[model samples]
Target: MRVSFLLFAGLLLAAVVSGCGGGSAASSEAASSGNTASGFTSSAAIAVTDPVTVGTLKGMSDALVVGDHIVVRSRSDAFVTLNGQPVYPGTRLSVLDKQGKLVSTTDYGFTLAAGYTGDWVMMLSPDGFIMVQSTSGTRLQHFDAQARLVGGVTDLYPTVAATSTTEYAAAENGGAVDGNGFWLATTFSLLPVTDKTQYVLKLCKFDFSGRQLTPPFMISTSALHPRVAAAGGAVLAGWLEGGGGMLAMWSKGAGAPTIRSINTGGSQPYPLVLTTDGKMGVLWNGKATMTSTGGVMGVMIDNYGTPLLATGRTDLTQETLSAHWDGNVRATVIDAHAYKGGIAIAGSAVGALKAGEPITDVLVLADYTLGTDPLSSSAQTILRFTLPGRAALGPTPVLRQMLFDDHAVLLIGDDNRLQAVYTTRNR
Candidate 1:
């Protein structure tokens, strides 16, 4: 995916103090009047509508939450227009949530320059300065968010990475050539906080009060691109290892990271998810054995990098592999039967005990609880969807992405269209 860079400049203004800040009458009056002179408004919503189907095909590049709104970007050369005006192509489309309706839309016109997995959208402008058009792509601002304008935009590198709920890491280059003919690597500027240079990676934590909790924590890697995932007060930082197309994971307070020892052997491993509950899962292509004879296998790892499961048959020709992980830490693997080519093999945390359960099947949602073994929990299937006509399952066949939100499962099928299946069981 191509990440675009656009200069965001508007005005300078202080953040509006909310009633929650203190019991001052000024703050109370501001709250009573509902005057959001600051770009950041207390109440505003966003949403998507009549999304353009690019080339008759739908593609979801990336998405993130800005306040109460959900912003989504498409990888295809597609632009979403509200009313009829075309939103800026490559710029992220905002979806605001208001009461029960989508209140407004805003286009920041900034292009993401890196992969979307670790990157997200952030609201840089204050509520009033950030004017959003209904569907006309018009620019308006009720308030501004940028208070201090650093050096001319040219000298400022607007690279940003989210570090926590209210904190972000931003860096800039001084535009000076170093001995290596590269731009003089200037110290990363910890924005919205202290101006002191204490660390190289420019690790700094800032709360909504604009206070810096800690000095920047330096890293050995000069080009360390820290990817932060915050959950339950734990922060996991993931970054790409130099030259080795592998990922390195480290926790903020959990000391050094335990690198993955297993070699991709050549295939690239994709980091599918890092759940808020601290469960990390990765998917990669490999060989596995199906019978006692011998064969290849598909590889999967747990949060601790433990190889808990593998799939594949001895015959080099049989390409059978599929896997899915539910909340209970149970993984379901579907593979082709080695001897019986027509018979599909289905294996789950519980199916492993059933010996030879049916193969060639679909997922069935059932209530499940964590078992002692973690990987072998039982789940009752409340519903199932069958897929017609079966072929030799490949390692990536059933490895489609599935996201669970609000008791609803959103599956991105091979066709790329999102199918949201919700569970209606009464609690």
Candidate 2:
């Protein structure tokens, strides 16, 4: 566990952007006649956590909806709340389900720091919230849609012999839930190999009831950061190795992952959008040649990690702020949520390149087709909304992908409140 919460604590986007699923019939009616912001409703920001109080934060990823309004968020310490009040006995794993109707918990076995960022993580499951908690060991707890304790918590560290002591940004992991179950892409430290810092990159799978079902798809690589998303029965991942980018994959029942090094040719491409399927995309930074500027580069791969469209440039404008490549600014806050046939990106852009220069604080929204060029000026819709007054944009904004009735919805958090605004082309 990396104890750098002071650095990473502020990077949370607050909400995951999955197209929201079926909800309670009453709240569904309330949402129909609800207040509209950029086309979605704006809910009042409630007092969810005591930020000033120092305690361990349970879940650091976005608060994903379990059934209806059952938002499963992480607390720094072992605790759960209802209506801003501690409702569970002692400090335990907590949940809220049934369109904000209930809050319950099952006993959690991890004793962790109160101020740690995201040792405990949550994702929506068929029954309810599935929490992956890391302490000296790993525990998986299951809850029902009504926020009731489904089964007992399963400690996987002993079952799988996989350590959970690795730096993992649950958001960047691209861990997804499909029809079969959920998949998480993360790294665990192995014994020092030849006195070198070596890691075991793994994609682990669990059944709907929080049981480790099969052997994980793993590879021994030097890449420190890897992102993963499940596409039906398979998983796709992208990571950096030896100053280059590579994409690897694993079938559900496969023994090991099939890895491939992406050949960028003469183009200097920066890693970017990786879809639920294995189709990888990159934004050319125009660093290699002055004439090429910026364009979209991608390679569409098949189910077995074979290339359908080998890496090539697509017809899109190359204006994703090349400063991210030149090291003018290091910290960036951004999130993208895939829904229906398209994806919605919303966040604050990087600060000005030169200090003391006038900066424009605005919220940016980009909508695009799955394989289409979103940076293209004419092909996709890009909107930049200047914030009220000369407010600043520092940490990434909290944006969630959801659906309000039939509209493709994007919920952006402004002034600490998440507004269900920013509709996309497809529903």
Candidate 3:
């Protein structure tokens, strides 16, 4: 299938946060699309409308859109928004149906008391596991697709944090990174391990029965900004190796990461993606060129981490959109995915976005064939949507935590309301 038809079904209808049962209609429309040379039968704009209201609590945090339902973590008394408005409290951990109805609710024993004040990290796996971590940093709780409680909080943080001051502090600051389905947490030095100085980020894999499959193993990376991805197959996990400027991958039998620098040096892998063959691909955005002209390109690496294609933008003028981060403004990567015959990337143009500043006309770009050896680039300015009345994602926005397809989904909380927005196109 072409990248155009690969909308997040959850991401496609996920934007109907304020609306009701038009989703099944929309999903049927997209799925039954005609097949064309460009791989799309029809090109249409996304249908986002009819804002309604429901819920009990003040608001919810760590929101996620799974398939056709909306799930979010909240205080002991979190509110669920049916349609568009907040109804009441204790509606935390709710599942909103396609009709914008609150179908089911779950609570992880969290209360907003004096000593307990923190957010829950709610993440969904591809195999249908709703993993949740509590307000207390060390505790972990999760449920299955049927919303049944599987177990209690597992205290592995203290054991992981024993060697260093930054391993797994009990402070409710940084939580786990939900990379696909693999749950990842950062630590300095783990037990029965060496390389004591370099920072280590490890992953925990779970079985169908919600059991930890493998012990926490150290990935080759030591930096935080350069993203990591779990592309299992021959390659288990991969991350941007900071010092060497390489796209590192650790296969199943490998003792260490197989490192191959995409740009030699002076390159930051904006976001990492896994191809259909379980290989590694990334959006190569930032560079230290003379005029700084690498404008959010598509780069694909082999399963062993070899750079096959390094595609810069052909549809854009470098000077206008390709601005580098010397100190101030910078580029932001919203999302990227592998299509039928290539890779498609999207997000902010270079130097396009700033925290708390409204973007009047935001356009997301999707390059169709960016994974070929010679870089055959057929790009599309897929969708253009704007926030209502000039709204900005404030400085502390929890956007990076959510998964995005062509349509971007957002949940904004202000004045006791959880405002949801979904942006997609009909093309």
Per-model TM-score on C-alpha atoms:
0.37, 0.57, 0.57
lDDT of 3: 0.42
**TM-score-superior candidate, 1 or 3:** 3
Task: Give the C-alpha miss distance for residue 300 in model 2, angstroms.
Answer: 4.5
User: Which RMSD does model 1 reach against the true structure?
Assistant: 20.9
Go through the candidates in order and give each one's C-alpha lDDT. Answer: 0.27, 0.41, 0.42
lDDT of 1 by residue, 252-347 (tens): 356544455334344333332233444433333343323211112232234444434314322211221222211111122222111111111222
In order, what is each prediction's RMSD in angstroms?
Answer: 20.9, 12.5, 9.8
The reply for model 1, stretches above 4 Å from the true place, is 1-59, 64-70, 75-89, 96-104, 107-228, 238-255, 260-262, 266-321, 324-406, 409-427
TM-score of 3: 0.57
Separately for all candidates shown, the number of backbone clashes (residues 3 or more apart, or on different chains) is: 32, 13, 20
lDDT of 2: 0.41
Model 1 TM-score on a 0 to 1 scale: 0.37
